[model samples]
Target: MKNYHTHTKRCYHAIDNEEEYVKAAIQSGYTELGFSDHTPWHYDSSFHSTMRMEEDKLDGYVNTLLKLREKYKNQISIKIGLECEYFPKYMDWLKQMLHDYPIDYIILGNHYDDTDETGIYFGRPLTKQQLTKYVDNCIKAIETGLYSYVAHPDLAYYDTDDEFYLQQMRRLCETAKKHHMPLEFNLLGYKTHRQYPNETFFRLAKTVGNKIIIGTDAHESDALLDMKTYHLAKQYIERLGLELTEEIHFLR
Candidate 1:
């Protein structure tokens, strides 16, 4: 499968060079690959580290990927993009950046709530109310008509229990269906051995019947080498009876 949310070492939490990732993609039998390293937010935020690629490096990142795209045009289709964390608090500037950059695609990674407040991936623990707001912001981000696909839609439940987070997941799946937006099913969750969105969310999505977009959420070159989790997730998806598609749309 094509990994649409691949990352590079340039992103502080990730570790791997672009070339190494390209080589891995070829070896993994992928036909298409998307390099969507985390885009540094314009403002300081608690969800991510400040050590990510600087503004000046954006061009180099683009140029390097363009060169690779050329080199692997025949072997694999490569697309360079960014996984943007949406913040309605900074909508004006956020919209400006989206227009300014020649980004081929955008992945909505809702790393924070509407108030620019809290998150589960970071040190901040969110309340049930906060979780609701975070999911709302993610849905709003998709409604804005900017992103190609929503990355980790179930991530909002990172801090909550399955029983408490179930309704929220249902609402999230409902929103995805309303907007015709796809929720990324990340395999890294299984690799890291986290409860992840929990099978509860996946089962709910199945009952509600929302579109599933498969993504490895690979932060490094060997990220996809974890074949066990991929197969397990595939089995889960098959059990749920949801169709996974490859037609990357929205911005195209």
Candidate 2:
């Protein structure tokens, strides 16, 4: 199987080194694996977070992954990528990063809104206006055509009104369909008993015919494809009859 949304210890919240994750992928019987650690941002304004690697570490991250890619070329296909949140203020910097680095792809994981100066984390309850803004930002990111897929498209949901939730979610799905970007059914959320893979959202996605992809969203090495978790995700997909996109074209 293939999984693009993986992480490394460089993102402080995750565990283990990159090579350990590679070994885990091989042991898990994966033919293709990607390392999409939380991306480092170079914002003009002061922005600090322990969740991602620092800007200076970006080169080291890419070099290490490229080395591993060549070393494991015959064993498994290794791809280097990043899982990023879109802030329009840093969009140009992100594009420059891609051009300067050997990044194969990027996945838009919108975890916050506004800017580094003032942002709203998705974990908290959001007003309808805030929710609409989140969806608009996601659509804007997709329209940039810089991301391979939209990861955890349902993550923006909090305690918003059911009607408003459905309305905004449908809009997100329709925009993804328009851009031909797949929406990730994140396995990490399922494993952790988190909010995503939300029934209402996926049902809307199914109705709108949005392409689906399964992302391990692996923060730790063992999470690559733990058999039980893998089966649970597979069953969820099968039961929903969602159309799964197995491969993606990297940015050239």
Candidate 3:
């Protein structure tokens, strides 16, 4: 098995070092593992983000993972990546980082609006206008060919009974299918019973013929050791009739 949605302590919200995760992946019988800790943006304003790593930590994040990728080459394949948000004003800086770093891949988190500096978190209930903007923003990000997949693609918590919810997410799913970007059925959400990785969204995505990928979303090293949850999620998605994938595009 392979997982590409792992995180590291450098992101502030995650725990342990990169090595711990690598070791845990090996113990969990995974053939490949990726570290996609939350990325730091070069904010023009003095605003700081509490969830991601600092801008200066970017080099260390990549370098440390590169060394581990080499060290563990005999045992498990390691990928160096970041869980990034598509902030329009900061795309230039993000592009520079992608070009400068040996980043294997990145996944779109889409946690906030144009910028987290706006304090508009997408996880919360959003207004109709905000939802429309959110879907459009995600579509634009997918079109960039920068992100490997959409992590927790059903993150926005809209009331499922509303037809508007289905319409907006269908648009997002169709775009993902068009771009060949798999939507992640995040294991972290499954283990924690988070509202996301929602069945309704996946059903809609299946109707759009979007492919599904399972992401460990491991905030802690031990999270990788949970084989039961992983298999359960695997069976769940497979039974949904959604095509499952383990491959992700590299940042070539």
Candidate 4:
């Protein structure tokens, strides 16, 4: 099995070093494990982010992972990547970052609207307008071709079963299908009983024919050692008859 949404302590919110997560993935029998720690963006403002690594630490993050990739080459494939938000103002900087670093891939986290510098968190149960805005931002992000897949595709946490919610999600799923972007079945949310990995969204994804990819979204090292959630998530996806993709397009 392969999982791309892994994290490291450099992000400040996760636990352990990159190697510990790598060992855990090997222990869990994952053929490939990607370290997509929350990435630091070059903010035009002095907006210090406590959730991701610092922009200055970007090189260190890449270099360390490169070494680990070589060290664990025979055990499991290690991909060096980042989980990034699509802050439009910093897109050029992010593009430059992609060019400067040997980043293998990036996944769209969409943690905040606009930029986390001054935006609402997407996890909260959103207003109809906020949810629609979230969908719009996701469509824009998908169109960029920078992100490999949409992690936590159903992140906007809109709780009721209403036509407006369905309409927004339908458009989101359709756009993803058109772009060939697989929406992630976030294992973190499922295992934690979070609002995401929402059944309604996946049902819409299934109907819209969007491909699904399972993401561990591992914040802790041992999160990878346990494969029960992965197995259960697999069974859940299989039972839904939604197509699950094991491979993704690397950024090269």
Could you tell me which 10 consecutive residues in candidate 3 have the lowest summed lDDT?
117-126
lDDT of 2 by residue, 109-180 (tens): 898895644788865677888889889999899899999999898887565348879888888899999988
RMSD of each: 2.8, 1.2, 0.8, 0.9
Residue 152 of candidate 3: its Cα lDDT? 95
lDDT of 3 by residue, 1-252 (tens): 999999989888889999999999999899999889999999989998889999999888888988998999999999888999989998999999899888889999999999998848888999888888889999999999999999999888788778999999989999999999999999999999988889999899889999899999999999999999999998999898989999889996
The candidate with the higher TM-score, 1 or 3, is 3
| Candidate 1 error regions (>4 Å) | 44-48, 115-125, 158-164, 250-252
Q: Give the lowest summed-lDDT range of ten residues in model 4.
A: 154-163
Cα deviation of 249 in candidate 4 (Å)? 0.7
Lowest summed lDDT window (length 10), candidate 2:
114-123
Clashing residue pairs, backbone N/CA/C < 3 A, model 2:
none
Residue 249 miss distance in model 3 (angstroms): 0.8
The CA lDDT of each predicted structure is 0.75, 0.88, 0.92, 0.91
Q: What TM-score goes with each of the models?
A: 0.88, 0.97, 0.98, 0.98
lDDT of 4 by residue, 50-122 (tens): 9999988888999999999999999999998899998988899899999989999999998899999899999
Model 2, position 1: C-alpha lDDT score: 90
Query: How much does candidate 1 score in TM-score?
Result: 0.88
Error of 3 at 180 (Å): 0.6
How far off is residue 233 in model 4, in Å?
A: 1.0
- List the candidate 2 regions with Cα displacement exceeding 4 Å: none
